[model samples]
Target: MNVPSNRPWPRAAWLTLAGVVVLFFIYWSTVASTVAIWRRSETFAHGFLIFPISAWLIWQRRREIAALTPVPDWRGLILLAVLGLAWLAAEVARVLVIQQLALVAMVPALVFTLLGWRITWAMAFPLAFLLLAVPMGEFLIPPMMEFTADFTVAALRLTGIPVYREGTFFTIPSGNWSVVEGCSGLRYLIASFTLGTLYGYLTYRSLKKRLLFALASIVVPIIANGLRAYMIVMIAHLSDMRLALGVDHYIYGWVFFGVVMLLLFWIGSFWREDERVKPAPPVVEYGWGLPGGLKPMLAASLIIAGFWPAYAAYVEGLAPNNLAVRLQAPAGRNGWRLVAPVTDWRPEYKGMDASLHQTYGKDGRVVGVFLAYYRYQRQDAELINSQNVMVRQKHPVWSNVGEAAQVVELAGRPVTVIETRLRSPHQRLLVWHWNWLNGPFTVNPYWAKFYEARARLLGHWDDAAAIIVYTPYEERPENAARTLQDFLRDMLPALTAKLEQAAET
Candidate 1:
């Protein structure tokens, strides 16, 4: 499959260019969202480089892309249509990550639709590499934190330093150390993985070696990150928390990463094969009917891709305003009476139009019932925003000590709720929370968002609320969870009605 890269050209390049123009408008919102992340998030700031780098990678193979025989594969259109639907669903669900990825996929899909599978296949690596542009990899932080803690604790113990390991915090004879989110080597892992993939593509022709090197890029960084955290802790421990405790910790971590990557590249140089890029061949005229040429393809592509945002726009225009909602506490039930919440600490429920905080007492224990009601759900005011948490990190007086899961009946059905054990200086608490997205109770924030998107798209009321239960625990997590469970069974009926009424009004 070969063709001339220069001169009079083929019909495919012109068609693909038109398709790209249509794509720009179709994915404008997604592009704006991704760009905002690149500007805002320091962690995903590397995403800003991915687009230009991908384009450069493709340009280095310009002759290869241009030389391949392009026969428009309608299969690409089929895939593109399917991806468009998926993107629509993602948009409706308000999952920015999913929608942005689907939008990025249009590049290859358009390539396939206009340039055919052959040309698209030749440029597959660069096309796939475009995914790094989306701001993702935040999910890696938790596991990275755990790995750091495990590695640091093991290293400390091996070095004959007395240590006690907890969840993310560990006690050492010299000082106390905790693996915070910053200590999680996610930034290193993402950078290493991205670089390693590109290096493997440019350096190796063999698939096996490419995969092996790419895997190494992933694996090495994880282990290296763990070791990096361990060394940083050791440096802090040895220096009596003077050296690595400041900005030097960041400097050391990045410096260590750079050295490790340099070493990786040096070793990979042994197996490095050239890209063998070639100049464009002499002009060879080729012609094929574009199934209606560039105009029709552009029109069809615009029609198919533009439908989602068009619908979203129409829906937004017709959506009702419900911002005047007033929230009230449910009536007392099962030997439980409503009382004022007797603490300064309030659950952080962001952008609530209305909220209810009532304390209920049964037997000897006091329970806090909080309902965060929103008349309409939007980006920041959504029921499941991360800002709406039991604790905020700025002051850092309270810490989530542990997680305890248990089954509890809600709305006449058994649902598993994630219970968290929180500890302050003087108080220990067990917290259970779930988002009431119309009806389904979900612990996952994203699922709540998905439900909100679906309901809103269907022209249904998008009113939602979060229900939180707090119970004091003495020494046992089980007792605290049991207290919450009993509280739910007694109060769920009235609570459900109250929430249902919130949506209705």
Candidate 2:
């Protein structure tokens, strides 16, 4: 039997294979389970399609993957370990699963490590294309919503419809129809872009063509979404909000989005070239018989390994004390009435000044609950006012009913008051009556260690902040409030001050 002499696998493949196995185990044991739970979350449930889509894409690219140059890379194994830990920590911290998709980190490490620097550089595009998995930049939502609303309003007006228009909203005298949150077209924009990207990649081999189609995928969705909103509003105006805003609204969107996507695919077909190409052989090299100077690399690997665990431990140790306390349920506090059972109420975490909550109803068929909390230790203040009202115009999935400010006294001290109301019917609302820190935050030693390690890598830290969200009957808002109060009470003043400073900046 003859083996390729140029192949470096005997030195590198076995190690990488072992590393891959270990990473897969870590994923299956921890990250995968957390991802499974995330699949049930509103922000990431769409990620359920990632695997199937990725599989299909890989299948399409099988010929390409097979043709890539193969080189041995023992060093990549270390990177593999590093990425695995990142994925695991992301899972533990309840980070957005899309943001943590292993392919973004792992695939690059695998490709670069084993294939040598030159080949990995050559194939950066396909490797980067894998990053479609990392759920990123719903940032497009605001702009997309703006465009959709503008287009819809204009289109409606052109059709001889009387409309009163403001920023992203308009009222038609035909009925009291305001293009609220759900109409913002964010869902369709995201869905269309995802599907469009897949279609572009599979069909267009040329980078230029792929990019053009990808841009079109993003643009067309917003246009189509606007049209969808216009149609629904027109229908409702002609008929009633019941038919448009009722059960049929989402069904209508799905139907229209499907049609628009079909059109996009049809238009995209014009750009594809099905030219034949010959199979290419993998380039291989094997000059280094033995790797040199292992001690420094080994030390570096060990040092890196300790990063996450240390951060996790620190966070655990710093875990804010839980100050469980019951706050009296308000029957009709500030026009927000309790329509559910009065059950358990306790502060869940100790970070902010205080938190308080109590349930107002039963489990399944309960009406609603009331929750309130104060954040003396404000974290991520920028995020508090980041809600894009214009985006809500087309995507009406998120609604800010209104907000009013009143000077409220807390601990007998006057503080700035902010209250915003958001209404989302389909989403299960949980009043996080406690620390609303964004991304990984927990005082568990393991979590703290993990966070610390990540900060060293990512080179940034997030401040602990508190936010109180209110929703219908989905969860016990009051209980959430209590949880918040306790957590805040336990968070020492020094830590609270640090968090506040972090947030202010």
Candidate 3:
């Protein structure tokens, strides 16, 4: 059963290695972007270890992989082509997450192309596991935060504590607590899932057990995070708002998460069926002869994989280098006159080509308008971006207490707008916002991105803007909503004209 230590490498191995290296170089930018996220984001820093772990996993099954003979599969080229085109579309749309996914997917496609189906199947888990490196699941945050807040509030009420909830923020007798991004339990969920999958792969041979364990991994952390938040609140409450209210809050969270993970793994290990290695079969000699048509297939594979990025570059090159946008305030009409901004609050939109903020008032009713314009958008500068928010999570001056999509009549047309409620200590305001991509207005971020991509692909100008209107309210939010609705009804035509004028300029 002793395998030779000095076995020479097979041609298939060489070809696979070379193809992977070439593919890495071909999509280095995407790879680098993934790595950059790992460097910057604590939640995704586990991405730094994913590739090395995948490689180690493959090495552990090297004997099984070595026993299989290589038969280069042309179907892999088809997969590569599809993935490349997907990457191209994401690139054009400035969607980094999709581009990273497509790029990571290419790794397996390349391996399948060079080493054939048998070896690819043998290493399927290792290859598939590489996808964990992607920095996805940020979309899950808002929901997770809401869930945590709900769970915490309900648990408090069950324990006879009076609670008043407003969106993700709640007030208790002890203190005020808000479930921000860090409290979302996303990091815990991701960590649990990653470690659980790996542990299941190593411990259990049955797919059913593996899947169940993975599912448990996902569920346990979310519930545990809720409990953790509740316990922290209780600690602060019991201590007269003195404990679990500072750095110790995060410290306790991590400690609790660690214990929960340990418990999950301990319970999972009870059904462990450890992998037992069998004796290696005799190696067949397929000499130094190059297989027929492999060279052409390899060449075609590289060509198909490489073409998308080049075409994407050409498409991007078609975009104008310098776009001069002149965004002017719309003229006041229907008794609303332009006036000074009463408050210093403004929406955060970074790297815009132009911006305008103005106030308009009529008969004691005042509304503020803010517009962020973009042309030739790129990373960190796109109209539809997570950073381009109405208010940050824990703003000193403003808190986004509630937000939802509402359809309202604008110039006698029903248009969807995102209505958000902003609260400060002194004032409460209702805001309506939507994106203007070229000509169409959409409250959905996905549609905005689609409009931008469509315009770019059609060789049309990808000019876009975020339009926000807000008004203060004292007693009821409905009054503020009515104020904004009235203002938009009076100014929709003029606002559209100004945006169109800027786009043309």
Candidate 4:
């Protein structure tokens, strides 16, 4: 026989192809959504690169890969089924991050099922590294923004510069500055972490060294970002808003990050341990049947994975898109009466199936009440969405919505809300808003989806709403806050009951 005794190249290749087909069939929805996120979000665009990079990593050691045999690890089938069920749970819960992770993890299970543990061991890092491609870190943005603002303010204070800060807004001697999302330095942090992880695996064999380098990658960028923000302010303050305001510290940040990364790699070079080994060829074994009893495993995975999404689709189909909440003026209380939408700036919840906005007044305190209700939370019409905020980004008078949203005890239950003050040429307004998903208040979009998915799974009506309260406050912020809180005290109990009843009806 003229076969290469060391390699199972021929049999391994066919089964690997088959494994890919089975996994894709099982997880197509997740795959589609993953790609969609990569296309839509600038933050996760690197997702498109993970696949080819993983393949290239595998190709770099083709000989080592070919040396392994198809021993059919049945344990891989068990793990595959477990992950499949997890994916099903995520699908029902509408948690995209969990779903994406489960899909990515299936790659390894598939490899192990088709070619056994030897091939799986050799390719583990590359498979696990694919997880970086998922859009997992957006939850870090709000905290990152807060940290940047605090860091910059401390640095300014150290330099003997007097700065007044509120939420993300700060006033310097030169001008007013707000720590916008772009300035949060999340891009730098994500880039640093991703590159550092890959660098660690490629360059070092010791786990401790890899972990330490990864930690440095995260910490350096965050601290450097705070410094970068400070330097930008200093540059603006020094130039009287001329030079750095135009070119400013954004450019400096990239240059600084580049230098830091280069320095990191160079320093990491000092203790690199090589783990590669040239293994003697394995004795040959031949006969390629359905691998790891994989046909039955694949059938079981498909049944488990496909069930929940199919059920969700059926549930969603039962609800008509045209179904909307019926809203009207709440009964008057303590001299409060519903008036027309008299304010120039109205909070917008576009694409909501139904909504109600009105002005109510009592004893010189005028409050604007808005209720945006949804029969179903899907696509554009939902309670917790970035696009449907109290103030949109493009609003002329209100661009600086506070980074620090507030949590208040409304009627003894904690409700998350954003408190933003909008200033105009002739008037000022104070705003507070929160999302009521099914039963409770939430400021998180992920949780909103999760709650809605749970409702659908449990045969409950998939209903949600947003409550916004704002009023004209020409005086100080404290006065505005007092009036709003008073109005909520009198108004919330009756109004929330009304909203809940509307959802039920």
* Top lDDT hit: 3
Ranking by TM-score: 3, 1, 4, 2
Error of 4 at 51 (Å): 1.3
lDDT of 4 at 48: 90
Candidate 3 residue pairs in backbone clash:
none
What's the distance in Å from true for residue 196, model 2?
A: 2.1
- Poorest stretch of ten by lDDT in candidate 4: 285-294
Query: In model 1, which runs have C-alpha deviations exceeding 4 angstroms?
Result: 1-11, 274-290, 409-413
Model 1 Cα shift for residue 380 (angstroms): 1.4
| TM-score-best of 2 and 3 | 3
Of 1 and 3, the candidate ahead on TM-score is 3
Every candidate's lDDT: 0.77, 0.50, 0.87, 0.75
lDDT of 4 at 71: 51
Each prediction's RMSD to truth: 3.3, 11.1, 4.0, 4.3
Worst 10 residues of 2 by lDDT: 376-385
State model 2's lDDT.
0.50
Give the per-residue lDDT of model 4 (tens digit) for 376-445: 6665566655567656653667654353478777887666787877765567778888787756877776
Best by TM-score: 3
